[model samples]
Target: MNVHIEVRRVNEAGEERTRTASIRDVARAADVSYQTVSRVLNDHPSIRPATKQRVLDAMEELRYRPNQAARALVTSRSSTLGVILGSRGEYGPTSSLAAFEDSAREHGYWVNSAYLRDTQPETIRAAVEHLRRQSVEGIVVHAPQVRVFDILAELDVDIPYLGLNTAERGIVELAEDQMRGGKMATEHLIELGHVEIVHVAGPQDWIEAESRMRGYLHALSDADLPTRAPILGDWTADFGYRAALELSHRLDFTAVFAANDAMAVGLMHGFRDVGIDVPRRVSIVGFDDIPLAAHSWPPLTTVHQQFAGLGRRAVTELLRLINADDAPPLLASVEPSLVVRASTARAFGHQ
Candidate 1:
């Protein structure tokens, strides 16, 4: 199926001929039809793995490069996706975003991102409009703040959209089960026989923070344990350290569950400075299981979220919506697991 065309050039009374590789050349190399090559380029899910690999190998052998402009004109598809971010610097969101981009590229798509400076309705609408202007086929919203969803609901977004961190059920969204993670962390502490456990939670407005706090309370309530009001934090080590100082004077709680690893590590440092040995006099658990968690002084006992899995699933679902293909089953809410480490132990004196 390879198409051959000759180009003639003359230099110093000498004639030369050459040819450039085309999609048909790739098809010939793979022993596939040109239409099969087109399907491979579009990452059609119906294509078998062996066929896809063969196409990819053929494209590489032929040095075939897809001309995005030409493909867009022929198919009327932009082959691009849009992502809107309300929280940019956090560990969990950033980790998920990296995985999402990697999955998109593997599926033969490019990503365009817009970072939100504020959660204002107008700002959210403007970001969506900007992405639409570039003809993105789908959009992924990574803003976990509660108000951001409210603002998004007010906008007249026409394209397919997926939410990475929203709590709304029955929506086209993929997210780690934050509430389950929180419950797992708290239940770990409870299993260690720590009844008076304090929770240092993230900002009140963040959907993740609220969901986690709800989990913590749910665990304590289910166990018939008295629940103390949670300490709201700004999801920072500095805030965790400050909270530790304030909690040090209150001898009421023997354990603390932090919303994320950064705060947990900082809280550990603060407790050490105050002479409260973790797992000895006080136990600590955190969420997200950031890379540093396992190396902290006592090694943090935390909940591990499937950030990468959720990211990949988000792309698959969004693409399904874009293609209007509902034949494939979608993954459910990602589950979280508890990683027990040195930071937690049986109740004091029971050890």
Candidate 2:
């Protein structure tokens, strides 16, 4: 059947008007039926290459764009992936998202993303529902909050879903070892002859924050070092600066380990403002080795997570779930590395 479509165009006067360029119009232009055009769009195996070329050429000539919804209805495949994020411009989540999109595109899939405005169950449900309506083949969740998963578990999510920062038993979680990274950061300071180490942590509810804090505590306990209370931060450089101002008045700790590079860099600024030299007075270390970590003043000693690798891995695993492939054993966690730099040094007396 020939289906006619009216496509709009503009004249030299820029007045609104109507133009028609239907599948039938494409068929006439290419000397084929509208059915052939539909088949071409769906990549039906039966269409000859030469005939497919004519339809494609006709589409190009007529500037006809196929409706994705219509195509999905015919093929029962949307070739789309959904990503749900619960970050406010944090480097790790943001970096991972970019890599995931690139990898999805490489696999000939389109990506749709939704950011959580809040962690309320209703918000998470809406985000999932919005993506599901698009007929996404799978969903990759990067929301790091503990409650996000709790809420997700409650939702009747029928599609294949993968989590990037969870270790829940039922959820397919893929993540770098945040605890190890935190331990690595703290241990580096301990190895530098620093005993009075303080932790600058992210929000209390975040999974990454909790994991890294555990690592810090574990390192301290292993060395039999006295533990002071960790200062909770909001994963912002500004918060680090403020925390620095508060800590500068004290003479207890000689080193600080931050949950993220942004806070680490801010801590450096705050210390500088208070006439405290980084590493020389208070050694600092951070996580996520963002691009600016090495470029920060005195350079930051931090943990390097393979965020991009994790993102690519997530896409691959999600696809496997979507395809119902014979799944292989999953990696326990992605390992993180420590990057030693000028920001950390031997504790005051040792130096």
State TM-scores per candidate: 0.80, 0.87
Alpha-carbon shift of residue 278 in model 1 (angstroms): 0.6
1-351 in candidate 2: lDDT tens per residue? 243345678899998787757777888878898998888987889999999987888888788877778778878889999998888577788888898899999999999988999999889999999999989999988887888988888885889897877776223333338887899999999999999999999998888899899999999999999998888999999999999999999968899999999999999999999899988999999999999999999999999998888888888888888898886846435578899999999999896
Please name the candidate that would achieve the greatest lDDT relative to the true structure: 2
lDDT value, residue 43 of candidate 2: 82
Top model by TM-score, which number? 2
Candidate 2 wrongly placed segments (more than 4 Å): 1-20, 169-173, 327-334
RMSD of each: 5.7, 4.1
Each prediction's whole-model lDDT (CA): 0.85, 0.87
- Residue pairs with clashing backbones, model 2: none
Residue-by-residue lDDT tens digits, candidate 1, 1-351? 243333345666576645456788778778889999999998788899999898888777666788876787778798899999988888788888898899999998899999999988888988998998778999988887878877776675788887877745213333337887898899989888999999999998888898899999999999999999899998899998888888899877889999999899989999999999888999999999889999999999999988888888778878988999969665755688899999998877667
